[model samples]
Target: MTTMNKLNQVILSATLALAASGASAQMRIEISGVGSNQIPVAVAGFADENIAPQQISAIIKADLERSGAFKLIDAGVITSMSNIDYGTWKAKGADALVVGTVAKSAAGDYEVRYKLFDTVKQSELSQLNVSRAPQFTRLTAHNIADDVYLKLTGIRGAFSTRIAYVKEYDKRHYELLVADADGDGEQMALRSNEPIISPSWSPDGTKVAYVSFEQKKPVVYVQNLITRARTVIANEKGSNSSPVWAQTGNKLAVSLSKDGHTQIYTVNADGGNLKRVSNSAGIDSEANFAPDGSIYFMSDRSGGPQIYRMNGDGGEAKRVTFTGNYNISPRVSADGKTLAYISRRDGNYQLYVMDLASGQEQRLSDSTDDQYPSFAPNGKYIMYATQAGGRKSLAVVSVDGRVKQRLTTQAGNIKEPTWGPFMQ
Candidate 1:
């Protein structure tokens, strides 16, 4: 059966905490490798009469720098683009330049206009205009960063997405936190003395499904991000855990132990329409859905834990992994061409990816304790939890295992990190 060995559950009731403090608990990010040549970019402060110029530029620079794809030039050199000097920026080794202006409209809203320039070619690349309410300053900055990233990399930026994870304050206290992709502006969604695990985001990025050991038994709950209201989607005689959302966002694929052994099942977002997806006698859990409406999950029916695939209606079961004795936590890419999972090799648990068509595999992580590997929406990066300096922290790596970065908190251990879907 699937187990929650990392969770220490000794308490009973789970308290629903709504709108807990939004204090900034910054996550320190350390970049490891520059997989490719970093693009040199300069973001000039927006020309505005009210807003501080340095504030907006700092956020944009931080976002691009963290990706390990762009090298930011000094904002002090060019505060505003009222006077264009392309030759100066080009001489400073900058390939791209960004300039923008922010103003308050007659209706008391903020309007921003930005332009992107190709410094080397000495031509304009793109222009964008955005408007937002007064309270959405940070969000506006992130959207600007997203636009710049997409324009340069040709891939949709995930800067505006959120991340959900479990943080243990002590042995008896644990909380579920949701924060920005850069690990700022954290808000606590749930608090309990019991343990919480396996947080999965819905397709719309409005709800999260997770397993909470509140009643001294594991139960799955889906909580809405806006109202903070939760509904028990799975609660049976035994454990109900490892909830994964379908592409449609109306159904969930989960693992249940009510039938004596762990088996994969699908249920509506509400607690109805229960259907079994896998009928294996051994253990089967950690289900993930592909874009093609197929279910990929972990199973031990073939003597050890390995990945398996089935249709949407729970038919045509087939083994997907054969080289590893222990493989679990299968996550398929959004394109449905690659599969990332945890495998045991040389008595050490590590992360590996396999081509779904060719059945060829390549190891991605060297850590012996990496877990909960998740793919970014762009399919360019994979985020997972690993131990660093004896502390459990979250780390991300490119698909080819070239670029790497780690995000760690100063206090307690961070676990079960799941990247949210792109904002609609």
Candidate 2:
């Protein structure tokens, strides 16, 4: 279910406090399907990679394969970029090839170099040389993958970005986890015996704002990722949840029930200057910002939950969704050309994407229970929460709905995934 539902059904009744702890479960990606047109690429092993802390070639392969945009062909020990193996790769059904080298300096720094080749065209597409400490081996690989993906697809890649989500170990234990975009390298930002929901990343990616049931009421808190410090941003008399950052990163639009009904309110990031944005008597929550600074949210003013759009500072609202009687969790694409949300049909909640200009909508998920649709930073894919085999898990699908994959942790159920911004 969406955060708005949780706020009404469970926020007032749950009771617990948050504690800091280290995250334990490692998430694994399982590709359930692939796109009809996939670029077959072979990523060769990097020379002298043993000196690094992580395998650069394997990480790149996993990143690309997980995207469902590339078909991985085994390179089989080829590591040198100097050799002209274009004909060999082309005959082996690889349209493109990647090769690189890794060197460790005496002072413990590392130099990572990689080159992308077009086997059919028999030419080098791009190359880069990066220097970083040993701890950034995986990140270096992700950067290389991003470059390769962008060069081939003409769209920027989101491999180097991060993601935030909620993990529920049990009814008594809950955690807010930050991890890589691929769902690995997780760190627990906040842990509680109660519930935590609506994890939203700031535009600059330095902090996160979320609702915590720490004091037995849903209160909004902002936590710095670098220092692990948290501050209460909203703690009104009633429920305070569904905190989403504005594009400028200086303000947050949150759902508050202080007015007797949940409504959208814009508050300063430091918890000052609270101002109401929506004046509707009906329930209004799940506020999302579009690229142009307009706010898209869910409101039941029309007798059923539907998405509505209003200006940034509480103007007249115009309904954007009319096809479904139930629609919530309105997430806008980075370009503002598409909107991804959950719509109920045939007694099942599924992920749906709509073209803002044409009003054409398409169903993107085959599962019965899907929620929390988060777009990749590149806007080519969406990562959402869904139920698989009765276990809550994360799923990613291409914006075209041609590709799909399921991401599951080793131990617990994961939900409310918010994909972070691209690294500056």
lDDT of 1 at 287: 95
Across 98-126, the per-residue lDDT of candidate 1 in tens digits comes to: 88778888877677777788888888777
- Pull out the clashing pairs in model 1: none
- How badly does each model clash, as a count of residue pairs? 0, 0
**Worst 10 contiguous positions by lDDT, candidate 1:** 4-13
Count of backbone collisions in candidate 1: 0
Native-to-model Cα distance after best TM-score fit, residue 98 in candidate 1, in Å: 1.3
TM-scores of all candidate predictions against the true structure: 0.90, 0.93
Deviation (Å) of 50 in candidate 2: 2.8
Question: How large an RMSD does model 1 have?
Answer: 7.1
The candidate that achieves the highest TM-score relative to the unseen native structure: 2
Per-residue lDDT over 1-424 for candidate 2, one digit per residue giving the tens place of the 0 to 100 score = 0011122112111111121256566788878678778999988888888789998999999999888889999996566779767899999999999998899888888888889999999999999887776756777788889899999999888987889899998778998988778877677778899999999999878788999998998999999776568889999989999999998999999999997999999999999999999979799999999999999999999999999999999989999999979999999999999999999999899999999999999999999999999898789999999997879999999999988888887788999999988756
